[model samples]
Target chain A: MIVYLLCLLLFCVGLYCILRKRNIIKIIVGVIIAEYAVNLLFILVAYRRGGRAPLHSPDAVIENMVDALPQALVLTSIVISLASTALLIAIAMRIYQKYRTFDITKIRELRG
Target chain B: MNYFAGMIPFFVVLALGGAFLVSLAGRRLKIFPDIAGLLTTFSLLLLSVLAVIAVSGGGLLVYSIGAWRPPVGINFVLDGLAAFMLVTVNLIAFLVSLYAVNYMERYTDKWKFYTLFLLMLGGMNGVIITGDMFNLFVYLEIASIASYALVAFGTEKHELEAAFKYAVMSTVGSLFILMGIVFLYSYTSTLNMAHMALVLAQRGTSNILLMVSILFIMGFGLKAALVPFHAWLPDAHPSAPAPISAMLSGVLIKSLGVYALCRVFYNVIGINPALSSVFLVLGTLSMLIGVFLAIGQWDLKRLLAYHSISQIGYVILGLGLGTPLGIVGGLFHLFNHSVFKSLLFLNSGSVEYATGTRDLNKMGGLIKKMPVTGRTNLVASMSIAGIPPFNGFWSKLIIIIAAVQAQEFFYAFWAVLASILTLASFMKVTKYCYFGRLKEKLKGVKEVPVCMKVSMSLLAIICILGGLLILPRGESLFLGKAGYSLLKGTSYGNEVFEEVNK
Candidate 1:
């Protein structure tokens, strides 16, 4: 329970940085933080008290293995976040090149 | 039956294959990307129509990967709903790609655009067809990332800024969805949506389920641009190239946001009174506020983007009623919105193509110089405004009637009020953009190319004929069948399992 609460706290920190920070790079870091927190939480949820490593071998007993599904899911989720992060960074670089600054408040060409 | 069963996975393969193939072949041949992209989307359109037929004949079809039975391996399940969404997505994709062939020449690399376009198409198709929750997330990210890149395709100041804002907000939304899925997986010990539905039904509702629902509402709502979560859309949609703007507004949000919401809530989470009221409130708020904000926009595409929010609210409102008529109306409205909205965006793209401006006040009497674009724009404007004989009217009327039948008088009244507001704003669009004497800056404009003209005309014809979908035969074949699947709700799990066993 405490660990889960910590995970939530980490996610909130990321959200706070994302909502409050004015730097584009900082917001990207915040996204990374929040994303890793979710990944950590997914891993945390699948941990078992007496779990053995989940590997399939001919002579090894496979009892009480921690749920391996979420581990695989988290790996895939990490890859996806990597792709998005790369794309985000690419866009941020272009934005910086165009605006010549990283402050988001200074970039206000698009507005209602 | 077996052949149709085999066609399910090909939707994903063909789209993804087309994406990579375009990238490879486009380097050698200048026109190869155009041909490959067109053939790919045209084939996709054909497959989705066949998919509808497949569903119409058989009840449900589940394609288990590697012959692994469901509940363990990834699965692609196609029913009336998936087929409906596929047809909607691919139909617009084909037309938009057709328009892009000519419109994209103004950009530097046409192949990159087509590659990302096909990748996005594949992602949307996968989202509609996949049965696993994690697979859905994967596909959702694929689509979202592609759209982010497409939004910044021009890489101009405004485009880059819009893309970054959209990417961050959408990534956060995707994380929320992922977090929800993780909790669900932990709770049920399964990732398959159908199996999870079974488990959820057995376990009944819990506080965790409530949390998941709220998370989803935020996640998908942001994707769908539901009012408060809608800050990214007006910037993102208008920033993309016109055909891309059309695609984003037309089908991406519907598949990623609306369809996912319906599938999860109605099927997996099992709809309840509290959830229903939540949908009603959110849907109503999005409808009124979106239109309210739209009227103030001078950017034509931005205004259409806001209308997307208003129109999607109608869809959610109808689906939330949880009645057969309401579901049908919502589903019908969804289909109609995709058609007319794509047309409106395409028309906007054509206008931009011709006059080199999206500002309504910058041009006038476009009806004389660019007759095709102006006329089609008028048709689309009427359709979106819910004028008689156009497709939007029938669906809006159905939703309004359904709302009254469900005795949600306030919502029904708002729906009507929004429709009227839609008319008033569109009239502003016509008066400023199409009607009156030609503006000084627009004197040299001409009609668009043949491909664009053909696609826009086809979409307008569909808009005018869209109401026919509500007829008995058409309804039973497509809209009614799709609505029926949603009406099945939690039985969706039982149906998938039954089909898999067979």
Candidate 2:
């Protein structure tokens, strides 16, 4: 329960970094943090106490095993996050090339 | 017919393969990207027609990814609603690809554009057809990520900024959806939508399902640009290239956002009174707020983007009402909105192509110079503004009548009032952009290219004929089946599972 609360706090912190940071790279890092937090939560959901590896052996009796699905899901989610981060980094590099600044406040060509 | 069912993977493979080849040889062969993009999208159009025909008989068809049965293996479920959505997505995709043939001539590395566009299309079709929650999320990300790149395709200052904002917000939304899926998976221990629905129904109203539903509402609502979550759209829609604008507003949000929202709420979760009320409030808010914000925009695509939000409000309102007529009206409006919204966006694209500016203030007397574009704009504007005899009027009228018949007098009143405001706004658009005196500075502008003109005219013709879907025979084939699926609610699970087991 405390661990879940800690995860929620970390999620909120990442969100705060995203919402409050003015640096483009910082915000990207914030997004990465939030994604990791969610991924961690997903993995944690599958954790079980005194769990053996989700493997079968005819000789041994197994009492508990971790949920394998969320781990598999997390791997996919991590790959997706990796792709988006790469794209975000590429876009950020281009933005720097265009504007010569890392501050999002300085990049104000589009407005309401 | 079974061979036709097996062709689903072919469409995905063709588009992705073409995208891959284009990206590889884009530099060496300039014309290759254009031909490949056009051919790929055209074949998708053909497959969409076949899917529609197969599903038009009001039965469900399931395509197993690897001959894996449902509740264990992944499957794509095609029904009336899915077919209708596919036709709308691929239809616009083909036209937009054709338009891109002419429009992207000024841009270098056109292959990248085609690749991202096809990837986006593949993602949308996957979303529309996939029967599992996690698969839907993966497809949604594929589409969303590709769209983020497409929105920033120009690599200009504003385009990059808009893309950054769009990418960040949309990625966050995807995380939320992923979180919701994790919760649902943890609770139900199944990812297949039909099996999950059965588990949920047997378990009955667990607190976890309610939580997942709220998370989904937020996630998908942000994607759909419902009033509260609509800030990203005005910037993102206008910042993209014109064809991208049409695809983004036309079907991306609907397929990714609205379609997913409805599928989860209506089919998987089973919409109860609580969810219905939430829909009602959100729909009404989006309807009222979107048009209000749109009335002041001078940027043509920006104005149209806001209207997309407002129009989507109508779809949600109809669906939320949960009556038979209301469902029919909502589904009809959904289809009609895709048709006319893309048409209007295409018109703006043409206007931008000829003038190189999207500001309405800079584009006057274009009608004198560009008759095809001007005339089509007139048709789309009239249709969207709910003028009598055009497609928008029929759907809006059906929704209003349905609202009244359901004895929701106040909603009906608001619907009529919103329609009038819509008319006023579109009138302002037509008068400012096409009619009145030709601007002295804009005298050099000519009509758009032939392909662009052809695409716009085809959609405009559809706009003129769109009201026929509500006629008796047309209703039975299209809107009726879609509405029946929604009205039947949780019974969708039974139908899908039954078809799969067969």
Candidate 3:
């Protein structure tokens, strides 16, 4: 229960960074943090007390095993976050080249 | 299995292969990208028509991946709703690609454009058909990433800025959706949507289900550009290249946002009165606020972008009513909006092509110089504004009537108010952009290329005739079945499982 609360804390921290930071790079990091928090929560949800790896072997008895599905899913989720981060960074780089600033306040060319 | 059933996975495969092949050979062959794009989209359109026919025969088609049965492995399910979305998506894709052949010449990397366009198409088709929750996320990410890159394709200051904002907001939305999926998986221990639905029905509602619903509403609401989460759309839609703008506004939002939301809420999680009321309030807010904001915009494409939000409000409002007539009106309006909105965007693209300006006040009397674009724009404006004899009118009327019948007279009044405001704003568009005396500097502007003219006219013709889709004969094949599927709600689980067992 405490660990779940801690995960929620981490997510809140990331959201705070995103909503409060003016630096584009900081916001990207915040996004990364939030994504990692969710991924961690997923992994934690799959964990079981006194569980071993989900594997099969001859002459070995399987008593308790952690869920393996979420481990696989988390791996895919990490890959997707990597792609999104890469694209976000690339766009940030171009934005820097054009606006010559890391501050989002300075990048206000598009508005109503 | 029917031969048509075998064609399900090909929608993704063909588009994915075409994207790769275009990227591979387009450098050497100048015309390869154009031909490959047109062919791939045309074929997908043909397959979607067949899908509609297959569904009209009154059975769901389930294709188990690797021959692994459901509740164990990933699968693709096709029903009335999927077929409806497929047809709408692929039709816009084909027409938009047709327009891109000419409009994209102004850009440097035409091959890259085709590659990303086809990739986005593949992702959307995957999202529409996939039956696994995680697979939907994968495909949704694919589509979102492609669109982010496409929005920044120009790499200009405003383009990069808009793309950056769009990317950040959309990525956050995806993470929310992923988190929701994780909660659901932990609850049901199954990823297959049909199986999950069955489990959820057995387990009944819980607090976690409530949490997941809120997460999904926030996530898909951002993607759909509901009023509260709509900051990214006005910037992102107009920043992309024109054909892309049309594609984004026309079909991308509907498929990824609206379609996914409906499938998950109505089918997997099941809707309650509370949820329906939430949808109703949100829809009403978006409808009024979106049109109010739109009437003040002077940028041609930006105005159209805001209208996308207002129009989507109508769709959500109809679906929120949760009645047969309401769903029918919503689905019909979804199709009609795709037609005319794409036409409007394409018409904007054509005007920009010849005049090199998207400012409504910068030029006037384009009807004399660019007759096709001018006339098509007029038709689109009328259709979106809900003038009589056009498709928008019939759908809006249905929604209003449905709202009244549902005894939600307040919502019905707001819908009518929005429709009148829409007409007023569009009249402002025509008065400022098309009807005044030809500006001296714009006198040299000529009609757009043949391909663009053809595509715009095609969409305009659809706009004029789109009302017929809700007529008795056409409704049974298209709109009626789609609405019936939604009306079935959580019984969607029973239907899919039955089809799978067969």
- Evaluated on the second chain alone, the candidates' TM-scores are 0.99, 0.98, 0.99
Q: Please report how far candidate 3 places residue B449 from its true position, in Å.
A: 0.2
Candidate 2 regions off by >4 Å?
Answer: B1-3
Measured with C-alpha atoms, the lDDT of residue A26 in candidate 1 is 98
lDDT of 1 at B477: 96
Model 3: residues >4 Å from true position, as ranges? none
Per-model DockQ against the true two-chain complex: 0.94, 0.77, 0.90
Clashing pairs in 2: B365-B438
lDDT of 1 at B438: 91
Q: For all candidates in order, state the fraction of native interface contacts they contain.
A: 0.96, 0.59, 0.86
Q: What is the TM-score of chain A in candidate 1?
A: 0.92
Chain A TM-scores, per candidate, are 0.92, 0.96, 0.95
Give a tens-digit lDDT track for model 2, residues B1-502: 3456777666567777877888888768878988988888888889888987787777888888888887878888887888888888899999889888898887877888998999999899889988888999999999999999999999998899899999988988898899899889889888999888888888899888888988899899989999888888999999899899999998999999989998998888899989987887888888888888889989999999989999999999998888888888888888888888888888898888888888988877788999998898888888888888999899998888888988888888888887888888998898899988998888998888888889888988999999998999989887887777677777788888888777
Which pairs of residues have clashing backbones in candidate 3? Answer: none
How far off is residue B113 in model 1, in Å? 0.2
